[model samples]
Target: MDTRTVFLNACNEIANRLDGFKILEKGQRLKKSSLDKDIYFEIYFQSSFRNDSSSILILPHINIYSKILKKWQIEQIKNEYSQGLIFGNQIGYLTPYNNWKEWNLAGLSYEKSINEITENIQQYLFPIFEIFNSKETAIDFLKSNGTKFNQWSEDSISPLDFLLCFSENETAEAFLNNFVNHCPYKGNILKLYEKLKTQNEIDLNYSEFHGADKIKLAFIKGLKII
Candidate 1:
C-alpha cells in the first residue's frame, strides 16, 4: 500500500479506538477533537525527501482548553503579545514516528506501522488526556504521580505547570515548594524562587526564563545571600 493509504488507515484505527472523538482529515494531517470540543490532538504525516528517497513521518500535537485556566492565560498573553491569546495552550511530544527511517530501513510492514501508532497513542497521548480532562483529575494525577518536571519545555506548559499556575491544593503547593528546595542553584536564584513561591500564576512574559529559573530557584530559595 501507498504511504497515504497506510496513513489514513492508521488514523481511522486511532479514531475508532478513541470512541466519542471526531477526526478531521486535512491533507496529510488528522486532527482528533474531544467530544466536548475543548481538547484537540493533531497528528501529522510529514513527508521528507533526502538523497534520492522520500519518507513519511508522524507527529503529534495537543491543545487543551480549560475554562478555569483560560482567563489567566488570556491576561498573560494579552500582556505579552498585546494581541491577546487566540488559542488554547498546546504541546507536542517525541514519538516513534520521528524514527520512521529506522523502521522503514528495517522493512517495517504497514500493519506493524499501524500497531506502532496505536501503541504510541496508548503510551504517550492518552495519558495526557487523562491528566488534563479536568482540574480535579489533573490535581489528583499530580498528587499521585508527582510533578513531571523532567518533561518541562519552553514551548508549552505541562500539566505540572498548569497545576502550579492555578491549583491551591496542599499537595500541589507542597510539591512545588519541595521541588524548589531541592534544586541546586544558589545566590541570585532566590529572587525567582520567592516569586514562584508567592505568585498565584506564572507570568507568560517570563516564559523564556521559566524553565531554567524553575530549576535554579528550586535549588537556591533558602540559601543565605552573600
Candidate 2:
C-alpha cells in the first residue's frame, strides 16, 4: 500500500470542500486566503509512513499569516515577503496537546479515515484559525500573553523575538543578555546576541537565516530600537 498516494487522495477530497482552497506541496498541504481580510491559513498534513506500511501519522501543522505584517517584513528586508514558504506562529507548538492523527488506511478504510480527518479539520482546526484572522488579533495575543505563549520561555530565543515584535528592543536586548548570563551554552548563544543586538541590519549575517527562519530574520531586522 502506498501511503503517499493515500494521503494525497484524502487531501484532494478535503481541498474540494473549501471554496478558495488550493492544493500545495504536491497535495501534502492546503492553503486558503481569508475572503474578507488579509489573513491566510495553511494546514500542511505533515505525513510519514509508520513502521507498518499500511498507516501514516499526520501532524496537521498550521500557519496563519498576516499580510500587513508580511508587508512590513518585506519592506524592511528589501525583498518579497516570501516567494517560498510563509511562516506564522506555530500555534500547534504553543499548545500542550499532541498533534499527530493516525490514519490506518488499510484497516480503517479510505472512507473512515477521510471523513474523520475532515471532521478534525472542520471541528478542531477551523475554530482555532478563525481567532487569528487579522494582525490585530495576532498582535493582541502576543502582547497579552507576553512570555506565557512560548513554552520554552527565557530558555529559548523566542522571548527576545516576541519583545522585538512589539518594538521593545531595549527590553529584548536586556532579556537576551540576562538569558546568556544563565545559559550553559553562553558562548554560542552570546555570539548570536552580538550578531542580533545591533541597530544595523546590514551588518547582520543574511546567509544564516533560511526558509521559515527568514521570517525571524525579517522580524529581527525590522527592529528600530535594538
lDDT of 1 at 216: 33
Give the alpha carbon lDDT tens digit for every residue of 106-131 in model 2. Answer: 55666786676666567556654665
Error of 1 at 161 (Å): 5.1
Tens digits of per-residue lDDT, candidate 1, 1-226, equal: 5665555555576556654455666434455554445544454444334312244444444455444345554553444323211122222323433322222211355457657655765675566666655556656656554545124322222343355445654554555544445445433345655555676665434443445533332223332222
lDDT of 2: 0.53
**Candidate 1 local lDDT, residue 4:** 56
**Cα distance off (Å), candidate 1, residue 98:** 12
lDDT (C-alpha, whole model) for all candidates:
0.46, 0.53
Mark the 10 consecutive residues where model 2 has the least summed lDDT: 82-91
Compute the lDDT of residue 9 as modeled in candidate 2.
Answer: 70
